[model samples]
Target: MFKRCFLTLVALSVFATVPASANGAVFDMGEQMIEISPIDGSDYYTGSANAQAQVQNTGGIQRTSFKQAIDSLEAAEVEIREEYAVYTQKYNEAKGRYDVAKAECKALKNNIKQINNRLKNVEKTKKMIFNNMPG
Candidate 1:
């Protein structure tokens, strides 16, 4: 009788320690949501559908499936690609303008150099003419 009572007590204690429900509670933390489920040492998923429904009903917490997440990422990638293309076009246009401006500046510098050389030649000719004149 004592052995049977001790065995029953141990069995009750073990069962009592186990949680009654495997589905956990979800906590809404303002921007994020967290779900804590009791690990029942089983690979079976019992609450995935319910969790998905809850996620859909709740607008703030976005728990998406793998496919949905991938689709969203792909959409974002396409948008980024379009933006990159636009920026690349703008950069090419700016580069072309810069090249044109740089060429103009180089031409201006060459013209200034030529003018200085001509001025030096004129000064030399004037000195020669003055030396030939009397007094």
Candidate 2:
């Protein structure tokens, strides 16, 4: 019962996250160069050859046909954040379940100990009775 309530609370919290800000920075591409908007907190993409050349020479940046590269990076960032949330929620639930199981096991161990103690006392009492009995 307690476990169910705890899980419900966790689920509600996880699903209740507010959507990310819609003002995601946009990327603009130019001939032989990539133009990224919101650069330095403004919405202008300078069309300079040196800048383009610099971006192009960089190995990974150069690989994609400009448009796909920016899109891929943006998608990866969003995915990373989303996957992190999912994995974290699952981990917390698993940890909670493990804790509950551990507690149950401890309780069982205590019960076993108590039973053993009672059995020992019974054996001692029986031995005393036999010792006191007339032959």
Candidate 3:
């Protein structure tokens, strides 16, 4: 009995140490609307946008604040892709990574007020798109 108890305890400890995928709520799929302003002297007074969404979480270890940072990065990536697509009319793999980094920098560049506002509004924006999704 004592041996069995020890083994069970050890097993439980191992399981406890193993990190589980995040159980906190996440959007299955959602859309984001972004507004892109034109660069001066650009051919078109171009404004473009893309659908942004979150399909997965990187686990719960990161705080909501940090995850928001990541989400902004992902959204920025999508934006960059849309821009590249518009300009070149061709796809390049590196554009995606550039967009992501741009967004991460944008989000991280701000102090608390701006960051908080951006993070807070993300869910609302996501839900708005989610609700509008086709049946």
What is candidate 3's local distance difference test score?
0.75
TM per candidate comes to 0.51, 0.48, 0.21
Give every collision pair in model 2.
none
lDDT of 2 at 83: 100
As a whole number from 0 to 100, the lDDT of residue 14 in candidate 2 is 69
Give me the displacement of residue 134 in model 2, in angstroms.
1.8
Report clashes for each candidate as comma-separated counts: 0, 0, 1
Ranking by lDDT: 1, 2, 3
Better by TM-score, candidate 3 or 1? 1
Which candidate should be chosen as best, given TM-score against the real structure?
Answer: 1
Q: Residue by residue across 1-135, what tens digits does model 1's lDDT show?
A: 999999999999878766443223222342255466688857886564544433346443454566688899999999999999999999999999999999999999999999999999999999999999998
Give candidate 1 regions above 4 Å deviation.
1-64
Give the 10-residue window scoring lowest on summed lDDT in candidate 3.
23-32
Off by over 4 Å in 2: 1-67
lDDT of 2 by residue, 1-135 (tens): 999999999988766653223223222224226654554835676666665434346665666658697899999999999999999999999999999999999999999999999999999999999999999
TM-score of 2: 0.48
Error of 3 at 73 (Å): 0.6
Show model 3 residue runs off by greater than 4 Å: 1-62, 90-135
